[model samples]
Target: MSVSSAIPTAILTGFLGAGKTSLLNSLLKDPMLANACVVINEFGEVGIDHLLVEKSDENIIELANGCLCCTIRGDLINTLTDLLARRDAGSIKAFDRVVIETTGLADPAPVLHALVRDEFLLNRLRLEGVITVVDAVNGWATLDAHPEAIKQVAVADRIVLTKLDLLHGVEGEDKMFAIIGRLRKLNPTARLLATHRGEATAERLFNMGLFDAAKKTPQVQAWLNDEALSKVHRHHHDVSRHDAHIRSFSLRDERAISPEGLEVFFAMLAAHHGENLLRMKGVIKLADEPDKPLAVHAVQHVFHPPLRLASWPDGKAETRLVFIVRDIPKQVIEELFSAFTDQLQGDAMTDKTLSLSRT
Candidate 1:
């Protein structure tokens, strides 16, 4: 299939009891998601019948809104391949997009790897973004106890704050803001929305890749959120103990980076610190292609082959990279890039450092 025809897929992930299923059910109710298909992956052997739908096949369910609901039978790849085959055979409804709801404890990186690195699925499905559901009431405690929860927020493109209604009075208000601050420190670039206020709509959650859904234009700036990250970096005091390990930062270079330099930097990064690098998205100014900047994305060591945009989205010729990492220092990344491009100027190359100062 052609790249344009590849179905956009979004992964919905969060910690155990973070309300991932509830948020997904709410999203599926929207008429805008009528053409969307959902692949639910539960932890155990027996899948939970949590979705509000009628069972049509053994594993496939037919939603009233014309959406298909299927549980992962063996693995994600097999389920997706089967869905595509059935769609091609006119055995099932054709879906414009796919939403994979992973088990609460699941790390979204491996799931992202399948969609990105898989040879066949690469041409068929495009990973649009990751929507992580954060429970406002218990989110603070959960993040403190579970490192998985921190990773979920770190890699998210859109974080939906759920269960805010339970956080009522002045004390609750204080708690709510504290958790929000922690989430921002972990991933400042991700768009944070509250589900209780009706903000987590299909319009805001999906199609969060490189382009705006309605305008069909590149929303590079919105996707990168470099400006917002910079703002959060200014105030790094009172770092939370839970979020001390997870860091979000940005790196920028005014000079055009050589193709070889860019490649070596990524290689060294993936080789040494790939495990800590949770998520990365950037717009690069290649020395050879000055006018057409390359848009790049990576989940850990796996990177989506860079796409050449028609022109710079923000009309800027500089390279900007935003990272949500665990225990990876800003200086280490800066030195790696400097070694390649000879553009390192000590701490000047580091645009924003959200890493914990103490630990």
Candidate 2:
């Protein structure tokens, strides 16, 4: 693949004062991200981070229009379109990947929706993953008080616990771990990493194949072995009447899904539950193409066009989808899938019989 095709876009999101800019600076210093194009959104009038980022020239675009969550969708689309046009025209060195650093107080759902819903953009761009930075010191309090913080964590494919160095050998260490444990419950599918001075490896932060990004391995039957999910599930079960605001669930079935049917189902789901659906990632077995599996990943409502892997990593044929949702019943999603499979089964049978008779 070419450089443009090789690169993957990532969204950096977190609540106010969660160290998003610091993380961005760290990423920019890394040689791995040298070919990155950054989009920065400032919540206030003065944009200081643009000055902080050591860009070569004109690669970093700042959207001073408004907060990304509310009023900058047009600017974002236009900026991205222009960026792509310049890249294709060979005006600038072809960028490997694009990174959008959202405002600290921004809600990422709307931003994601705009990226995935646009017809022209969706074909060219792919949502690699969402990286949410959580302040190790104030994370618990922030999640408890701010709905935006909850949404940030909920939609993340990878969660980075920042400011760990500040808590060294102090009482805050235990508190930070406990907070991370709680966040694990909120988003078990997302890999959790501890970052010092906002520094981390690209391999640890990205390429999460909806399974184990850190391990670079597929989790099929091992999904049940994820300690984060089990620990959180137990905690929720222990406190049944507590704040049931956010719930995480994993659904796996042996049936293979058709690519067309999967597309329609995802489009419908995104339209209906754009706000409620936080993060979704899954590895699917397609009925028509059993030799290759489809990998589906989405942050909020934006989905990367399904990627077809050469072969299943571990020879497992099951389709597994993990969802981190807010106030959305697990049964609703389950029923939707059940209905889709039933309808598709009928069509599959007809196609199979027709093919057999022709042969």
- Tell me each candidate's TM-score: 0.90, 0.77
In model 1, what is the error at residue 15, expressed in angstroms?
A: 1.6
Best candidate (score: lDDT)? 1
lDDT of 2 by residue, 97-213 (tens): 677778878888767766767766776775667889899888878887787888888777788888877786658768877887778777776777777743466766755433222
User: Ten residues in a row with the worst lDDT in model 2?
Assistant: 62-71
Candidate 1's C-alpha runs over 4 A off are 43-52, 211-218, 233-240, 343-359
Task: Estimate, for each residue in 1-359, the C-alpha lDDT of model 1 and write its tens digit.
Answer: 65567898999998878887677777888887988888988424223344556557877888877888888878788889999999989999899899998888888998998888778888888788999999999998998888788888989999999999998899999999989988888888999999889999999999789532223335776888788877884455445566787888899987888897688678767877888889999888989989888889999989986777778777888889998888788987876675556754446433322121112
- Candidate 2 residue-wise lDDT at 346: 71
**What is residue 291's positional error in candidate 2, in angstroms?**
2.7
RMSD of 1: 4.9
- Alpha carbon lDDT at 116, candidate 2: 69
- The whole-model lDDT of each prediction reads 0.81, 0.66
Candidate 1 C-alpha error for residue 233, in Å: 4.7
- Which candidate tops TM-score? 1
